[model samples]
Target: MSQPIPNFYAVIPAGGVGSRLWPLSRADAPKFLHDLTGSGHSLLRDTWDRLEPLTGPDRIAVVTGRAHRAAVEEQLPDIADLNVFLESEPRDSAAAIGLAAAILHRREPDVIIGSFAADHVIRGTRVFEFAVRDAVEVAREGYVCTIGIAPSEPAVGFGYIKRGSELIVDGARDASLVERFVEKPDLETAKRYVADRDYLWNAGMFISRADVLLAEIEASNPSLHAGLIALAEAWDDRDLRGPAVDRIWPTLPKIAIDYVVAEPAAERGRLAVVPGHFDWDDVGDFASLAKLNSHGRKNDLAILGENARILSDAASGIVVSHTNRVISLIGVKDIVVVDTPDALLVTTSEHAQRVKGVVDALKLTGRSDVL
Candidate 1:
């Protein structure tokens, strides 16, 4: 077992209505609260398991919405009151992660914080541990370090990280200076990035000292930094925490860390990327989940849920069954059928990204109960 890093804290930002994985992933119950990987535990629980070894059980905080506090607590029984930072409203990743960072910084000024998403899948614990340890080592050097996944394919679904010259820091020989981060590129750009050998998939995993992150936020976006500082000051007082969230959270900017902190920091030569060669997937949609259980047989159907109720005949696509009834497929190819009690989605692997449009249509047509 790897020893916990000194004063290292893991912050999980678990707020986002994963509408693309909807029907199964709802507003109140997001994708992070579901067991899309068939692990019998929710993704939030899985995230805790991944970070527990590096920071121990007590050093991790899950920043989620106030409504999901009960769910987060229920899933993680060992999580303390202070560790479960509840936001009164959704203000995007910057506010969610920055709030936790500020609170942790106030408690432990020299703490190193690693911010990871709540709904990601990672295999190979030893490799992951090695990368995190290196990240922490780099973080201790007063540099904002991000874990960059080695791109296995030219996948345009994820953003790319351009790696520059290597840093000569001790205990972090593998760490490279981040040139800049690119948004989800087109297929042609993604292919070139993969072949160039200098780009990696932006995994959204970052490790840095609490003060460093806060300072970058202040430099790049001062308004957000002020709101976060105010909330952190009132975090311990229940009387103030509630009112502060209500007032300042909505006023804060709704931007991602890639834009507000990591990207800008990279531009100013303050960001680093530790290349991680692990089997990692964000599981953005049903198709991504299907890749986890794919049989590698083009003629074989991939099942994500209960297999007892599934029987495929001449079908070779993904079937995500959440219902009790039998989900049978006959003669369909490359199709995606997601069955739930409220809604049943039938599309193809090619159109899996369009599922978010269904959620938008439902909202526009006044179908809130299903959404």
Candidate 2:
């Protein structure tokens, strides 16, 4: 219900094959482009919906692969073509987000930029906005800020942010200094993290002044910062932009934003976290996909795609059918069946995380057509 944050721009880094969701998610068409929630909307559109209220459509930008440009533009017709940055090839989060920061900073140095993922599903927009408002306030104070999700369960799939003392910032009462950024841990460590009030799930939501973000990047990784600056300088000139990207993008270091800035900033006491009370899910794997859609019940299951007939007896799993072929299940539990025109994936929810290995094996067999 609050007004949009002034001068706050949002950048969505929409890259990732989501190989764990193999067959259903491919290199050309990733999961972000799919309506995995069965809500009749792609995750990218949902993300735009969540951020549009905070920054408006004009202030939002998206960075994705060149191959998905048409699809991204089709889904987000409101987004201006200039706001969409296409990578010649993959360059990881550091380059994607850093390039965004560099260009936005070039346009408006005082701009507060927030980098969010495209594939996350979130509920409770009001809480989300409140947390983002707080993060913006923290960002205004010259601190690199991130919105950390309040952990609902002991999730080992996500990295954890340990909160230090509470930070005192106007409009950001719940803000806290980040103690450290911890990587994904074992089950026992994750359980302890859940029990401890100091830890929050790292949802990859970073907010900071565009200039400040670039300064941090310059301090940590000078070569990457230089490349981003070069590309950003040429961003406005249509003729030079393509040549700049083609030449500089491949030469930039391939590193994630976490390693490039978050962890190092946390160590220097420059990183802060605003705990988000909203329901958030990255939908990393099929098990998470089941949870998001509220599927995998003992008697009932989730069926995605139209004109797909399914019959089940004592079955508990999900079925995603792209074809009209009837799928039948008997006495099966936690199974995931994905039927496509070219490929079909049948695995249990228990073995869902290992689905990435399947993609790796397929790659070894030179099965690029299915992938």
Candidate 3:
């Protein structure tokens, strides 16, 4: 018998507050919507565009909070209205995935689903597609296949996946069974992980047959699994998704898909990792963005100083905007100077990670205007 052509579905989780890249990224306008690279398209638009070949406009689903539904829809007009799932309140990724799984399960029982975040940047589309194709084949065999990016550097900010013995499959590159899942490690540990070559960065891109993930969730976090199932069952009974989400989502436990499902599956020898060769970045913070873009030199957009000596070591000119007035800097150094009507941010490229702390402090002091 000829092999069946796989039907693919995608779920994008777009509910993060983007606390790390504040001042630019706020509660009202999240990170995914921001033009971090000054590119016309936002990160969410980039992600959605990348998935066009795999899921098309109709087959993809976006899971976002009610607050951002209009923006999500506006940015992704290609996606149909019915495919958008607006949560009543913001829950973490685990709940988001569960809800997507439940929704897709009701419609297509045998389809392979790809879960992705809206704020990630992925290069090399062809390589990425190949990896997903390989993952689809792996998921067909009942394994929850996660695309694991081979680490190019000792990144301490992301989770790591330990690969086991390689499994040979026909018509696809060899994949490794997941030996274990590790949280973000320290610098020394990250270096060791890179040197061993047995570890890959957890890209947070998941692929599996709908039934497979549901089964794993049932086996691992039965209560959460049950709650998801209940919500799915009653989804059409009433609009139990909006206000009800805030009341019930907090009780769902603050766990990630890795902890609640992937890790346990790895322990049971059912989880696998597909090696990723594509250039990928989660863009978790402002430092990563500046580094990736290399806005480090005086000529770069990092610095905006008055009568300042700007050294051009690849950094661009600084960008400043206040009300209807625009200010441009001619010379600067390894710094970021942003001036808005209500707020101003000035820092060296090295201290961008502290922006989240500033956001937290703002929230604590009720400085919502600047936040």
What's the lDDT for candidate 3? 0.77
The TM-scores, one per candidate, come to 0.97, 0.97, 0.88
Candidate 1 off by > 4 Å: none
Model 3, total clashes: 9
lDDT of all predictions, in order shown? 0.89, 0.91, 0.77
Better of 1 and 3 by lDDT: 1
RMSD of 2: 1.2
Candidate 3 accuracy as TM-score: 0.88
Q: For model 2, what is the alpha-carbon lDDT of residue 247?
A: 93
Q: What residue runs in model 3 are displaced by over 4 Å at the alpha carbon?
A: 1-5, 237-250, 295-299, 302-332
Q: List the residue pairs that clash in candidate 2.
A: none
- Specify the highest-lDDT model's number: 2
- For every model shown, the clashing-pair count is 0, 0, 9
Q: After superposition, how far is residue 301 of candidate 1 from its true place, in Å?
A: 1.7
